[model samples]
Target: MLGHQLLWPVVAIVVMLVIDVIAVPSFLDLRVQDGHLYGNPVDIVRNSAPVMLVALGMTLVIATRGIDLSVGAVAAIAAAVACTRIVESADEGAASAAILACTTALAACVLLGVWNGFLVSVVGIQPIIATLVLMVAGRGLAMLVTDGQITTPSNDAFSGLATGFVLGLPIAFLIALGMVVLTAVLTRRTALGMLIEAVGINPDASRLAGVRARTITWTVYVFAAVCAGMAGLIIAANTNSVNANSLGLWIELDAILAVVIGGTALTGGRFSLAGTVVGALLISTLVRTIPSIGIPSEANYLFKAFVVILVCLLQSPRARAALRVRGRRAASSKAVAA
Candidate 1:
């Protein structure tokens, strides 16, 4: 069933290659330096890594027919908190200031996650309304964390999460990859998978079947918050500075697009993590290719707009049904020919 899901993407890649050969000629070599790889592909992976984490959590939320538009806010707040604390601790004469800062960053993010969890789980507020409060107020919280000052920190090890590497791979990319694999295992192997799907299909039915529907909903939101927090820290690490207003802005939209493009239905009850990765790659590639072909920056966004529309159209029930119907017809024709 999953292999069937991947068919069109595989075909798309082949078509891209054929087009590249005809038009760009040397398009395969997207390198910018002699040995150092650079350009849109690299930039895509770098920028997309943090969002991938957030999108991953969003995918889970969406699977349950819910949304968390506040992840971007949480991410920004996490970044601000991390930056402010790191700078403050250094000023306070801590011996291992960077370590303290790192701990503080992660701790702050977890606290925010807990707060989100409480509001969504314990308070029983609608996920959209509940998360919206934080979305609006979170930047203020971030500003308060730094006393309304932009935070600057000088730390080598702290920045390494975004820039350094244990192997040749970027740490950001590796972390995102690990999350992809982890989600794959979580949804594919455990009873949690069935429970999540059940909840998505019908909450009342799921509850009657002994599934803790509310608990699942709570967990998904918390998980999403944690991922957003982690992504915030990563972005902070990458840039070494934090501005509450600028960080993680409007990222919720991108996550939804990625999930939908990967074949996950917004209506709930279905998700595909592997498909999400391909969707992310597709997004990254499209963004990268625009400038590679000399398109203007404003026009580049237009390209993204079109691809998003195209992917969403392909995921529509009518389109999916058509594909399945065609596949079944092919099978019938083959049998008759035999």
Candidate 2:
């Protein structure tokens, strides 16, 4: 079990670091000429920010033994709402477009989260089906928000959230870090996290013990939506433009991959936030190292798939059981021969 906890992400990190170290050969002889890191780490950090946020939520959702297929759609819808408000604000001159964009996105996210919570908890809809409704319609709503036109906000304050940096780090990175700390605090520092775990491990038992399962599930969805909102804001700020159709596209997959690769189980029984963080870093590093070695972008998907396969391969209960059986068989043969 300890081996399972330690191996995959460590291997991934070591491999990535080695590739990055050898990223440029002797002929290339590339070294840092500027005060910055040897590589342009901003893009990787920025792009991975959203995925990390989503995965953090996914870690909770998966812990509940529920899957949220609508996070990508939620992100798109949130961005659409933010951009729509930005465009409207620009026309009316009532407020800065950036402020309006973020506010609207966050508000919409909270409402949508409540909606998801309602369906999944109160209405008893299955998690997948409940979220699927939003998933299918969210992009269309996003198109409606902008009248199918892309929006670019001129406001610097809101854009600064994505673009501005502090103390030599991207602002988005700080935001992601803050959220991670909050998550850790919520789960590890308080009973909130314990309740979530108990509910995830066994809902009926948790309820029998006087825990409110419905409330727990609802809060989880809301939390997931907030994360999605943050992700949307980060992406929108980074680009300074919002394309409803393409913005935050398919990011849900990355989040799930991160959550799973970090050693969190898909079944609602186990979670490890630290593992998820490492998984996110491993993914970003993998993507960054790929092009450095002249590998095609298409290979990245394959590479991630392979890593996920390994995560499942080495840690699966069946694999451990098989190993145990093999060990026992060898012991039995030795004892009989003796």
Best by lDDT: 2
> Which RMSD does model 2 reach against the true structure?
3.8
**What is the total number of backbone clashes in candidate 2?**
1
lDDT of each: 0.76, 0.79
Give all TM-scores, in the order shown. Answer: 0.84, 0.87
Task: Indicate the residue-level lDDT of 58 in model 2.
Answer: 82
User: How well does candidate 1 score on lDDT at residue 211?
Assistant: 93
lDDT tens per residue, model 2, 54-163: 89988998888788888888888887777667666735333465666677788888898899889998999999999989888888888898788888766677677776
Colliding pairs, model 2: 65-268
Candidate 2: worst-modelled 10 consecutive residues by lDDT: 27-36
* Alpha carbon lDDT at 78, candidate 1: 77
